[model samples]
Structures are given as structure tokens and as C-alpha cells.
Target: MSNGNEAGDRLRVGSAPDSWGVWFPEDDQQTPWQRFLDEVSDAGYRWIELGPYGYLPTDPHRLRDELARRELTLSAGTCFTAFHRGDVWEQTWAHVRQVADLTSALGARHVVVIPEMWRDPASGEQLEDRSLGDGSWRALGTGIDRLAKALHEEYGVHLQFHPHADSHVDTQQHVERFLEMTDPELVTLCLDTGHISYCGGDNLELIRKYPDRIGYLHLKQVDPRVLAEVQEQDLPFGPAVRRGVMCEPPQGTPALEPIIEATRGLDADLFAIVEQDLYPCAPDVPLPIAKRTREFLNRCGAGAR
Candidate 1:
């Protein structure tokens, strides 16, 4: 189940449930969990992330046995946070604790935290201001810092903040400001290539500017043609994803080879997990695409050689 890559670099390439088109804990449209595990392993990826908390087995023993039999490993878990929204600490922590408990139990040390999107991801309706004010900004910083500390102290996991499309921290400027505002020791960037590019951020530039804070990687690309249309229509992430904004590798923007190369220059080994957002895709669509994307990433020199 190894990527069978040349062993000269520190990049550990993996795929996630997103690449399998799983977005919710239970969904008729998404791939089934057992099939996802079987296909991901068969597709040649050795590592994976828990996309939604309940999408996989929360019972550590059962989940562990499942992954064990497949010869796959857990890299991290995904969680959504809205610290900018006042009075969300308890609610946020409650959610994160559940995710972290499962993440840590599976021996994964990273929790990828996505900021709550300003617009509803499902409905494309504006749910909050696209921009946060000074007060909200301070709250976001404070709340995230506090959460990072708790995740480390309590669950022994690090917080990898993911700047996402339509969220307050989606832009390059927003990411840099967030880096400046938070403590680097506790917080790091997940550096989701597709989302950053979707928000018009530069992947290589961010890597060069803050190499140390780059903790994890989501290796995916944006289809510029689709992106242009998405921008013109002002589509929300869900609709844009449905429209194929996140394209397969070797078919999109911010070429991944250079980005992977830049990450190699860092001091730590990073998980460059493939996460193409394919919500509501056909049941049979993900496996072949997953195989091709895995092959494409290997050609990009993702496997540390």
C-alpha cells in the first residue's frame, strides 16, 4: 500500500474522503465508507483523512481494524470553526473535541480546521458579512489561539487552519494577516491549493513567505476556465464545486510541481493529501479519477524523490 515512491524526499502523499466525493456523515449521493476505503487503497494511496466526523467509523477499534486490513493510515481529521461569530466557543469546542478524540485515537496528530463560510455552502445564500470587522477579527484570533492550545494540551493534536473559499480568511492578504495574528507554534496552515487558488491566493508565494507555518497540504487544483465562470456568476462554493471548479491535477491552475518542490525545502515531513471536492458526484466517478489524480501527483514528484 505504499505509494512505492522513490525515497529521497519527505513528502507523504495521500488522499482523503473528499476525493471520493464524501462530504457528509450520511449522504445518498456520496460514496459509501467501506467502498471509499477499498477504492482508496486500491487506487494506490496509503494515507487518508477523516472528511466529516461521522463519515467513517467513530468507534476507534472498528475503524482501526478496517484501516489495518486495507494497509492504510489516518493522516488527519477535518473540522469547521466559527470563532468570529461571538458566543460559539462551547459549541465549537464540543464539535472539535469529538473530532479530536477520534483523530487522536486513530494516531493522527493534525486537525484541519476550516473557518465557517460567510455564505451558506449549500444554498449559496449570504449568511454573514464577507468581511469581518475589527472586533470580529480580534475574536477570531483569540478564539483560534485558545482552540489551538486546547487541541494540543488535551488531545495532543496540532491545529492546521484551512483558509477556504467564501470564508473571511480566503484571500492571500487574509491568510498572511492570520499568520501574523496567531502564534505559529500552536497554529499552522493546511495550505489547501484549490481553495487558496479559488480565492485568488498564490500557493508558492505563501510557501516562500511563511515556510515554517506551512504544516500540512491539500493537493488539488482549480480549473481556471470554470473558476472564471464561477466568479462571473458569483457562485457559492457548493455550486462552483458542482460546476467543476476544482479540477483534476495536470488540468488546472497553480501547477503543483513547483508547490511540491517548495514544500520539500521545509524542515518537516508534510502530508500532501489529495482532496478534490466532488460533492454529489456519480457513484462510479471517484475511483478512476482517484487513480488518475494519484498517478498525476506522482508525476509531479509528490513522492519525495
Candidate 2:
């Protein structure tokens, strides 16, 4: 493994469409796709995620041409699933295989597979039944492994499991159990730093424990005050997100520097994707935030030594 600074040369810093407030369809103020491309490019980001698969061009050639025009390239996209719920194996595979096809065509090799929460985000349900039973665990693990392995063998796309807040697997215990059950060869990890903190999980501790299992990275920052409120009130993921639980890099809590420091000196390419959970912002808000985020990353560890 090379030193952190040496490895930094291969580490490409990219931003996601989440910064432009494109998480869900209900967004009151979604930025136009063309405007997003222009701002991200203007902010000096050469690499970016495809956001939701369809938010950008679905046609592979058109997608590639759009990216090329902006001097930008696509990274992995987020894939939401709930394989633990019922007999959705075939249903799930149809979606996974379809997305894998699009992603591979765009020269991306990773999909951030996250579990869909079972309960209402704003309801007072307390995000219940989040932990799966032994049988569900086995089923979920095997199903993900099968999909991941297939995606890898067939499309050369790695399915990285992302443990999210208010989902089936949220806490350290839940994530650790998941890593224990899933096959490492097929199923890997996409560590979202912000979500880790949002769930009260120790981010650095997790990385030290499972460095190689991490195939993707979502560089987000948690606001401690908002997190405290969320945890205290047992707020659901939906409301928490709308409340702006995540912020720009400098405004986030626990700090990302230590997390970046821990990744130093590894040979693997770090596709560090900046995903700030913003929503319904002014048209002009994201560009400046993106600029500041790029500046923060470059100052810490975005560039080569």
C-alpha cells in the first residue's frame, strides 16, 4: 500500500446531486439538470455521481456526451432496496440488473445499495422492526451476495451496501452484524460518514474495523445539534432529512479530517463522493456550497501531495 499522500493522487473528489436538492420527487425546489451540470462544472468538480439513475439522461450515449461536454465523468449511483421485506427477489433483481446495465455503460463500477426503511419517517412509529430476524438476515445477506456477485461477474459493477439511518441496518451493531453475515467477495460497503454519525455510530472505529470491505465512500457531515434533536425526539429519517440534519463540510460535526487521515497510505482508489443532504434551497445556494466543499476537500486531502 502506498502512503496516504501518495494514494491521494489516485483519489478523485466528486460531488453528488444531493447537494442540489435532488433526493426525492417531492422536493419543493429541484434544480434543473442542466443547471446542476453547469454549477458542478463551474465549481471545479471533474467527477460526480449519477444521482438517481433517471435524474440525468437514461440513454448511455447521451449521458456520456453530457458528461464529456462538462469535462465531468460519472461515479456510482444510489440503488434503494428492501429485500428483507418480502419475496421481492425477482422484483429487486430486475431493477438491479437494469441499473447495472446503465451504470456499466457509463463506465461506473459501483452502486450504493441501501435498504429502504420499513416505517414512516415523520410518524411517531419510532422506526420499529428495523432489525431483521435470523431468517430475514440470512435471506437478505444471501440475496445481496447473489445480486452483487451477478453484477460483478456480468456487468463488472460492485454493489456496495450502504447502512443508512432509520433503515433495517442503522447502528454499529446492525452494520457489524450485516458485515458478518454477508459474503465479502460479493457484498461490500459504502460508508456514509454523515449517516454513521446520525445513527450515533463511531465513524473512525468502523473504518479501522472494516477497511477493505469499504468499496465506496459518501463524504457527508452530521450536525451534532440536529442529530441530538433527532435522537432525542426519535425523529424519522424523512423529517430529519427535511430538517437539514446534514450540512456543508465545514459546518458538519465530528469533522471529516480524522476520517480522511485514516485513509492515508492505501493503494485503493478513493472515490470520495460529497453528498450533503440539502432540500428545496434557493437556485443560487448549491453553487457556493459546492465551491466551499471542493475547497475544503482540496485543503484536506482531495489533491495529490
Lowest summed lDDT window (length 10), candidate 2: 1-10
Q: For candidate 1, write residues 1-305 as lDDT tens digits.
A: 23434321677888999998887899898889999999999998899999999999999999999999999999999999999987799999999999999999999999999999988877789998889998999999999999999999999999999999999999999999999999989999999999989999999999999999999999899999999999998899999999999988889987887787777678888888999999879988999998998887777667622
Tens-place lDDT digits, model 2, residues 99-137: 788889989888889888776644536544857888888
What candidate 1 gets wrong by more than 4 Å, as runs, is 1-8
- For every candidate, C-alpha RMSD to the true structure in Å: 2.5, 2.8
Best by TM-score: 1
TM-score of each: 0.96, 0.92
Whole-model lDDT for model 1 versus the true structure?
A: 0.90
Instruction: Estimate every model's Cα lDDT from 0 to 1.
Output: 0.90, 0.80
Residue 27, model 2: Cα distance from true site in angstroms: 5.4
Q: Give candidate 2's total backbone clashes.
A: 3
Residue 287 in candidate 1 has what lDDT? 91
